[model samples]
Target: MKLTRHMMPLLVMIALLCCSLNGFAAHGEKKPEKKAILLVAFGTSDPEARKVFDRIDEQTRKAFSDVEIRWAFTSKMIRAKLAREGKVLDSPETAMARLMSDGYTHVAVLSLLSSARDMETVAGTLMKNIPGRKPEDAVIFMGHGTGHHPADAIYLAMNQVFQEIDSRAFVRTVEGNLRELDISEIPFERPTRF
Candidate 1:
């Protein structure tokens, strides 16, 4: 019935603790879904190339308005060169690790590479290996292909490579399309294995 100054602080803290517990009980039953988009690129040291990268990044952010956007460069040499110029670049591995630590439940990666290179491999491996990364998650690589070059087949080959590993991963080109491959079926769910 009697309260002193020393007891007041203790009472207030106890009340706050009760409120916190109530808050947790009310909302902590279900975790909030955290989603992110990571745009991976080979990265360039040239200003013009950087401008193109920036434009692509901006467009991607616009398209994926809800999810948080991050960037990673797959080229170590380009990263080093940019670092010398006072620019920071996160590698694909680094970005994925950070996203996992940040509690993202779903991640969609869009890589701006012309062909299946080291970056594509890294993206595919990370998507497959990231703990708790689900079938709903997507990894897409965009390439610049030309009809005049035989190298355009690389994109189709990479797409097949992704399909074999996980259906959610896809590779496509701006100027190329494979008759056997359909872009409409991207972000596909994998068949359950018994």
Candidate 2:
């Protein structure tokens, strides 16, 4: 089953709750639970993009000051690219293994990107709240797509959902099957004259 962005925090909370309860159930004195948060990203080789990641890391550290924070990059290509420049980043698996070896009882992994449903909600809300938007005005959302991955279908699905939410709203991708979507296919209606 696919895990949604909205579910990540809930799952983390539940894991923490379970860990606390389990500690209480122990026969002897309670043991302190070691918890950590692992932020995973697709990663980019661009030095400028590293600033954004730094900001996220800073904010996460501030928010969870007591909990240990770590990072992992999911893209092997990006990791290798960085490695060539004498910088190394751990893969998600490697990061998790290290945390386990360090005796972290609970590790929460968080990643960017929302699930299809969450994307739909965001699109719908945006379409509804546009300033001075007319019925004939069209709103298009552009996204990056994995050219050949099965996940590319998410772009098409989101496009369909956007159109359903507002016939004038549409979605397009930069590098996917729907990248060449014809404008004529979009259901754009002309405003009616009184």
Candidate 3:
């Protein structure tokens, strides 16, 4: 296989083809990890809470860069009842559906759960619905969690929500009295849940 005038260009072409094939394989091989963060609120019919929740949504977006993030009312009943009353809301289901349809692979849900009671259940159940998504994907739910409040139900509720979402996703609940907590010690952290 001595290099001749004709063979020189032929060998060069072969080398180029091999390099391109390698480049294509390398570039097309890895599937980038998908992620998103969602601020899930118990939602407000009060219209006043809407203003407060607006701040939460804005802050969460600024925190999680490169991760597709947005807001939603986790309480379908609250959202339904109020949306009819002209709150003009996007339900968590609707929001999640839009994100997934728009090519989001995972969504981290931050719930507006001041008191565990119905609010946590409302948010958790709605977030759990995120499981039946097309392909297996993660849906995170962050609770406002239990604090030094008189009632103990909030922590219990957060634990319950954690149980529901943990099997599918890496979930976390931040109650002041608990371990492994994140985002604790805020003024409105212990607000009365209506």
Give every collision pair in model 3.
109-140
* lDDT of each residue in 89-186, candidate 1, tens digit only: 88766676677667666666665554457446756665657565555666666666545445466667777777777777677666757533454676
Model 1 stretches astray by more than 4 angstroms: 1-29, 113-194
Worst 10 residues of 3 by lDDT: 185-194
Model 1: what TM-score? 0.45
List clash counts for every candidate, in order. 0, 0, 1
For candidate 2, report its TM-score: 0.57
- The Cα RMSD in angstroms, rounded to one decimal, for candidate 3 relative to the true structure is 21.3
Q: Sort by TM-score, best first: what order?
A: 2, 1, 3
TM-score of each: 0.45, 0.57, 0.40
How does model 2 fare in lDDT?
A: 0.74
C-alpha lDDT score of every prediction, in listed order: 0.65, 0.74, 0.54
Per-residue C-alpha lDDT of model 3 across residues 65-171, encoded as one tens digit per residue: 67887777645577789767766667655665666555554555555564546555665666647645532343445544335443335555555565454534333
Q: Better model by lDDT, 1 or 3?
A: 1
Deviation in angstroms for 2 in model 1? 69
> Of the candidates numbered 1 and 3, which has the greater TM-score value?
1
lDDT: which is higher, 1 or 2? 2
